[model samples]
Target: MNILFDVGASGGALLHNASEMDIDLRNVDVIVISHGHYDHTGGLLDALKIINKPTAIIIHPDALALKYAIKPKFRLTGVPHTISEIKKHGGRFLVTHDSVFLTDSVATTGEIKRETDFEKTPEYYMLIRGGKVAQDKLLDDQALVINHEKGLIVITGCAHAGVVNTIRHAQKIFGRRDVYAVIGGFHLIGASDERIEKTVESLIEINPRIVGPCHCTGDKALKIISDNFAGKFTEVRVGTVLNL
Candidate 1:
């Protein structure tokens, strides 16, 4: 099945890329939103219009909740479009909070169970829970797992749930097996030096064949990760493609 992961920050670029790459957006079987963050969900409505059909969209229930950055200037950081807007454009929501498979081998991690001490969530982001505004644990943060013969390929989007924890969650569901690839944002931007160091070390321990960290992963962390992984590291970019 053709699957489109996270719509990106805007429609212009996404649509352009689809056309240029000869990707028929209309044929996308399903679209998965990594989380509620605007950058991850903003292009969804536009994409739905392209599909022009009742397309299934897999997402976390909490992804629809209002989100904000409490400090460094209060700002809305939640999904830019509403349910009504997306539905009007042909989105059929399949919301869930537990790991759900899209295929026999590919699935979403749902809410990652935090397992490490160093990996932490954004303390500045806040969200409404139980009718009270509180710290946004970003429980909606999730990853896509593709079980391969050699191991698993884990893809994450702004892993606010923590990279190590996210990988571990996938491991738990798929059985503790070798990870073939670990890609997507580590979300370590502006994180402490110690945290970055620890995260890189943990990634090395995971020993994935391909390490392509991008998006919100800070430059320092990326450099360290690439350095440590060496020949195994793959640079994630707009035109980058992986055979797996």
Candidate 2:
């Protein structure tokens, strides 16, 4: 199996090199959105138009809505694509609010439960509805787990759910902790020093074979992981592809 469709990555990562990468755009089987952010979802419109088959579009329902911050209140908006819109474009929409399997090899852990008490959600995240704070728990934040021949691989978008939480959920879902690798955004941008330290500690505890932090994982966090994990850490760019 292959990552037929990825996060709505902008700058035409796949769009510019679909053929060279040997990925058949017309045969894409699954499309997984990491979050509602445009940078990860912006390319779906064109991708959908190209895919001839009915591809499964997996996403959390809450992610399609608005996301907000509390401290000083700034806009970090979510993409404005509803399930209906996806269906209109012939997408096989898979709306998930809980852990579910999309296939034998591919499954989503729904919204990962914050298994660790130490890992706390950022305070700035808030759900506003009708000009009211909804205290959204981000129940739809999910990750894709692929059971490869080597070991289980976890692919995430932004990892709004704690990275530790995402891993634990993957372990539970697969009934094992033998993670071959984890790729994609860790969402550790702008994290405090303490948080970064804790995150590094947790990653070392898990000891994944490979950690490819891309997108929102800030440079400082990447450096810390590299300094600690060394050979295990690798850079993930738009054209980068990791095979299990």
Candidate 3:
């Protein structure tokens, strides 16, 4: 049941980190790309080669679309590898917009539904559509859901779909509200204090047994979440592993 989720900024970094953790890339059963972001998918080709065998790579088709960060300056921020390249490197891609069950208790949320008004993906980029620049709805944003014995464990990448929405989507798919843990980027960077506060309150209602916000969760938001979650908050880092 070895699963790799969202490769890091570079393939070398992925390999280095795996080596540090004593993880053999060859044994990974599957690879899941949370979104098309460069940080998440840049190592795809290298990972595929490391596996060197037929492997299922789960991701959304929209992850291939041209993506950019328009602020400060327009910068490309999408997957660096081509679909053909991936296929040539022992990659069996499963691109879809529906839940994909890896196991009876493990699956992806597919396309998360944005139900909260305050929980919106910050305007980071304008995605190309019909040869025109359009607002990125990030419909491809999804998360992994694990039906643990205590409750569901949701893992996200960037969380452009909104963490609450991601969790709720997991709950809907799994038919449970009890979440054991949530560990990943919440994408609350540069968000308003009000939004961060509201998000923490919403999370309190969901009441995950453990909350580990990392990456794009933002420093300010992390402090707020830490303050609100208190005993339940866990500091996540590279090599940090959650048993549940």
lDDT of 3 at 118: 90
TM-score of each: 0.97, 0.87, 0.97
**Distance from true position, residue 63, model 1, in Å?**
0.5
Candidate 3 lDDT by residue in tens digits, 1-244: 8899988889999999999999899999999889988999988888888999999989987887888888879899888887889899998989899999999999998988889999876576767756888777788888999999999999999889889999999999999989999999999998888889888989999999899999999999999899898899999998997776
Q: Which portions of model 2 miss their true places by more than 4 Å?
A: 9-14, 17-22, 69-73, 128-133
Alpha-carbon lDDT of model 1: 0.90
Q: What is the TM-score of candidate 2? A: 0.87
For candidate 2, lDDT tens digit of each residue in 1-244?
4455354554266567775677667767787776666667767766787785577887777766776666666766566466676677777867677766777877877878887765666666767556677766666677889877777788877787878889889999988888889887887888888888998899898999999988888999989988998889888885687656
Instruction: Tell me the lDDT of model 3 at 125.
Output: 74
